[model samples]
Target: TVAVVLFTSDLRLHDHPPLRAALAAADEVVPLFVRDPGVHAAGFDAPNRAAFLADCLRDLDASLRRRGGRLVVRTGPVVREVDAVAVECGAAEVHMAAGVSGYAQRREERLREALGRRGVVLRVHDAVITAVAAGAVTPAGSDHYAVFTPYFRRWSRERLRGTCPAPRTVRVPDAVRGEPLPSRGELSGLSPGLPTGGETPGRERFARWARSRLAEYEEGHDDLAGDATSRLSPYLHFGALSPVELVQRARSRGGAGAEAFVRQLCWRDFHHQVLAARPEASRRDYRPRHDQWRTEDEAAEDIAAWREGRTGYPVVDAAMRQLLHEGWMHNRARLLAASFLAKTLYVDWRVGARHFLDLLVDGDLVNNQLNWQWAAGTGTDTRPNRVLNPVRQGRRYDPSGAYVRRWVPELKDLDDRTVHEPWRLPEDRRAALGYPAPLIDLADGLTRFQHARGRGVT
Candidate 1:
């Protein structure tokens, strides 16, 4: 009998449980990927992610070919396409990685139901896309944990399974037919600085980061001007690198930095589990915060300014522009920029979340949406009302103002202190600098945010 390996988010060959299971179940395995139109229709198929995905698929196909097998690609509704391939290959079982989003859950159910009609078995593998599968550990009272610290504590104590080995060789049945791999060039409007995809590139990055910076990550991760954080989010988002291996290797090294890095990975899983339990968190407030958020009409121009990186707040604008150019932003930048938009601007969190997804290579429903909620005072933030002061944050994290100057070139001539607030320059100096006046007075913005929350400034 033939076994079909259904590739989903977990695209790499190394440390893939579903692929290993499929290979063990049968002599001939058809590595299949179905491009579901539903994803495109739902707008999850953003251009940058599509480009990154194309690279991953091409890379996975190449890896399979080197082991004497090739990927089988098809397009259409996933259930229909998967069933078609199974029948054509005469496969008796299909194996896929479990996913957390609502769409993923729905697709798994539909695939299983469709295959059941053909008398074929469908197997779903956990911990393929995350270090620990969602729901592996939960608080006693609820289906999911609402906060990160408690979840992280539990996740830390639990033991993880060892990483799986890549198959020595994979054999493809000659009878299978497949489509050509997608070209990333065909994707339009991709960010110019988006990183290359594939397991090889991911492994290389992990190795370099482990040897050079893993130790410093504990103290230096938030040093924005230093650019010290690991640029591994996109790789993990695309499943080009195994989170299981990342945790294992980092733990074996056993340093304070590795522990800190592992904690961030747990945060990733925390969001995943929350999304898994409450898929509506993707578009709705997780806690139903009674926020009288400002309407688009009231904040349209401010939102436009923020999107164009012309907010007149150097740090926030720099982060937004960096995201536009790089398809990624530093973690501290993400928090500060997000807090600026959702808290200072008093805009809806969805607006900022949508824009981030539009440009972020690591854009994911769980992390992006929930993190937005956390910033908006509607999610699990213990101190939900705290606001990030842009100027203070800029001076603190970007002490030299180098990061702001690098991305917001209009202020390039200004020195460190003046760079954080060009509006404070002498009238003639500000005019010559060509930087716009502050879009909204910082005090007024703070007042609006507090008033929106039905509270005065503390």
Candidate 2:
């Protein structure tokens, strides 16, 4: 008997339930990945992620070869390709991890229907992409938790399934056709500092980072200049790293830092659960503020300035520029930058969400969209009217201006106090710096935001 394992977001071999289940149920297993055109059609195959995914595929194939098997790559519509492969391989079962996005839900339904026509059983595994399954725990009278604190409490108490060991040997049927693997070099326009992908590098990074930094994450993750947060998001986003394994590893090294890190992981699952319950929330507001937001056309120049990292707010610009250079940004930076665009600028949150999706290596539909909503006062945020003041945020998180200076070199010569507000410099010095002045006065922007929300200034 033969089984087919369809690799989607959950790419790594360790702790993979679908692959293990398939391997156990069959004499031979086909580790298949379909490069779905639907993903491209949906605008997910952005250049940075495409490059990172290419590296992931190449590395996955190499890993499989070392284990006496090889990954089978296919292209076209996902269901059609998956079915065709199942038929060609004479597979009795097809297994995959459950996904949260609307596209994934539709794709899963289509795959089940398509495969069932040919007598192949489709099995979907949970807790593969997320540490906990999306629908695993819920409050009474609710399909999902709307708040993170209660959700985190319930989520932490739930027992995780133990990790699976990588198979010592994987038997694969010969004569399975596959496309040529993708090359990272062939991908262009990637961020100059994009991290390498694949399970090997991801594991290695975690090993070193966890030992040195996970212990300090609680106290230091927000220190912009320290760069203290684990840069593991891309790996997690790609499923090159296992969330379950990460949770377990962090828990074993228990402390405030690990607890903080685990809370972050719980937040990831929280978003997944919310997204699963309401897939439409990906594009629409989970809790609409009925905000009269500026459209892309109405805010064209401001949008351009924000995207180009020239908004004249040092912290906001630095964060945006970091995303351009590294395809990632610090968590604290993400909040303030998002707040600037969605609240301070009073532009539509979707506008900033779309831009981040276009560039961020870790741009996930579930987390990215919801987080934007939180910042824009349109989601499950309890304090919807609260705004992130970038100037105060920069002073607190990047005190001494090293982070701003690192990304916005135009302020390298400014004193600590003036770096964050270079418009405060003398007229000649400010002009000499060649940096734009504050795009809009903070007080004016705040007043505009509060008024737009139909509230008097708080």
Candidate 3:
């Protein structure tokens, strides 16, 4: 008998539960990746992510070849492709990792129903993409935890399964047909500053991070200009690195920084569990706030200014510019820009979330959606009414204003305090610099948001 390992988001060879299980249960295994047109039709296949995914697929194929196997590439609907591969290889069992998004859950259900009709057993593995599987820990009453802190406390106590060893040999049938690996240049509209992908590159980064960066991550992660945080979000999103292995290695070091980094990873899982339970959170508010979100047309000018990095707030503009250039933004910048859109402008969170996903290489359904909700005060934030003042946040985080100067060249000559708010400069000086005035008075936006929340302006 043969078994099929259906590759989805989980692309790497090491520490993969579904792949390990499939290899052990059958005489020969088929490693299959399908390029579903549905994802492209839904407009989910952004150029940066497409390039990264191509690199991942090619690297995975190389790894499999080293183990006496190769990846079979197919292009079509996912369920039909899986069935065709199963029948071709004489496979009676199929294995895949569980997913949290609405599209993912629906895909799984369809695959199961289709495979069952054909008399092939389908098994979905949990905790393959995450350090802790969703729904593994729960509060006393709710089906899912709406709050992250309490959920994290419970998650810390749970025991995660040990990482699986990479197989030395993975035998594939000689008759299996396949396609060549895709080239990055074939994808269009890619960001000029996109990073390289694949498990090989990811593993090298992990080694360097563990040796040097991981220790200072806790203290330096929020430094906007320092660029010190681990840039592993894309790798994690693409399954280039195993979350389980990351946690294990971090725990081995056992320091304040390691603990802090582990907590962030836990935050990633926390959002996953929330999304797994309520996929509607991807679009709707997680906890309805009865918010009178401003119309897109009404906030069109403000949003346009924000997106083009002409917000007149240097820090905010710099972050927005970074996203435009790199298809990625610093974590702290993400929080600030999200707040600027949802709270400062009183614009809908969906608009901002959609824009981020369009370019973010690490644009995950769970983290992107829920984090946007948290900043919008419609999700699990304890202080749901909090607003990040761009000026103060910039002054605090980017003390040197180097991050701003790096991305927004117009503000490069401004002095430190003046960097945060260029409009404070004399009209002649500001005009000479060619910087725009403040898009909206900071206090006016704050008052508007406070009134919407049914609270007096601070």
Candidate 4:
């Protein structure tokens, strides 16, 4: 008997349930990956992620070859490609990891129907992409938890599935043919500092960081200049690192920092469950505020300044520039930058979310759109009206101003005290620095937000 294992977001060999099940059920397995044109049509195929995905696919193929097998790559409609592979391999069963998005759900349904017509069985595995599968633990009356705190509390007690070991030897039939693997160099407009992607690189990164810095995450995660937080997000996003294994390893190490890190992982699951239950929330507001948001026509200049890192708010500019160069941003910087765009600038959160998805290598619809909504006062944030003052946030998070100096080089000569507020410098010195003035007064921005939200300015 033969089986077909379809690789989706869960790309790695380690702790992969779908692959293990396929191997156990059949003597020969076809490891298939279909480059679905539907995804490209949706406009989700940004260059940074495309480049990273190329690296991942190459790594996966290499790993399979090392195990005496090879990945079968196909292109076109997903269902048609999958069906063709199954027929060619004479597969009795097809296995895949469960997905959260509406598109994923629809794809799964179509595959099931298509395969079922051929008398082939489809097996969907849970806990492959996330530690806890969506809808596993839910409120009595709800399909998913709307509040993260409550969800985290429940998620903490649920027993996660045991991790799966990678097959020591994979057997593939030589009859199956595959296209040549893609190269990252074939992709253009990729961020210069985007990290290399692959299961090996991700595991190595986690091992190094978990040993050295996981202990200090509690104290230094928010310290912008320190850059102490583990940069494992891109790996997690691509499923090169399994969430189940990450949680298990972090807990065994056992410290306040490890505990905090686990909590952060739970947030990832939280967002997944939310997206699963409310798929429309990806493009629509989760909790509508009836907001009359500013369009590009009305806020074109301010939006352009924000995107180019010339907002004249030193810390905000630094964060924006970091995103442009590295295709990633610090978590704290993400919050402040998002808040500035959504609340301070009074622009639509969708606009900011679109730009982020355009460049963020780890950009995900569930996390990115919902986070933007949370910052814009339309999501699950308990304090929806809160605003982050970029100046104050810079002083608190990037105290020595090193982060700003590194990214916004024009402001490199300023002292820590004045680096975050260059407009306060004497007229001659400020002009000499060549930094633009603050685009809009902080007080005025706050007042505008308050008035739009129907609250009197304090």
Tens digit of per-residue lDDT, candidate 1, span 122-178 = 999999899999999999989989989999999999889779888879988888778
For residue 229, give model 4's deviation from the true position in Å.
1.3
CA deviation > 4 Å runs, candidate 1? 455-458
In lDDT terms, how accurate is model 1?
A: 0.90
Estimate every model's Cα lDDT from 0 to 1.
0.90, 0.92, 0.91, 0.92
Q: Candidate 3 — worst ten consecutive residues by lDDT sum?
A: 449-458
Writing each residue's lDDT as its tens digit, candidate 2 over 244-287 gives 99999999999999999999999999999999999999889788
RMSD in Å for all candidates: 1.6, 1.4, 1.7, 1.6
Task: List candidate 3 segments past 4 Å from native.
Answer: 455-458
For residue 270, what is the lDDT in candidate 3? 94
lDDT tens per residue, model 3, 148-241: 8898899888898999888899999877777787879898888899989999899999889889988998999999999988899999999989
Clashing pairs in 4: none
TM-score of each: 0.98, 0.99, 0.97, 0.98
lDDT of 4 by residue, 1-458 (tens): 89999999988999999999999999999999999988999878899999888888888989999999998899889999999999988999999999999998999999999999999999999998889999899999989998999899999999989998888989998888789987888888999999999898999999999999999999999999899988888888889999999999999999999999999999889989999999999999888877788998899998999999999999999999999999999989999999999999999999999999999999999889888888998888988889999999999999999999999999999999899999989999999998999999999999989888875222
lDDT of 4 at 364: 93
lDDT for model 2 comes to: 0.92
Worst 10 residues of 4 by lDDT: 449-458
Candidate 1 vs candidate 2, TM-score winner: 2
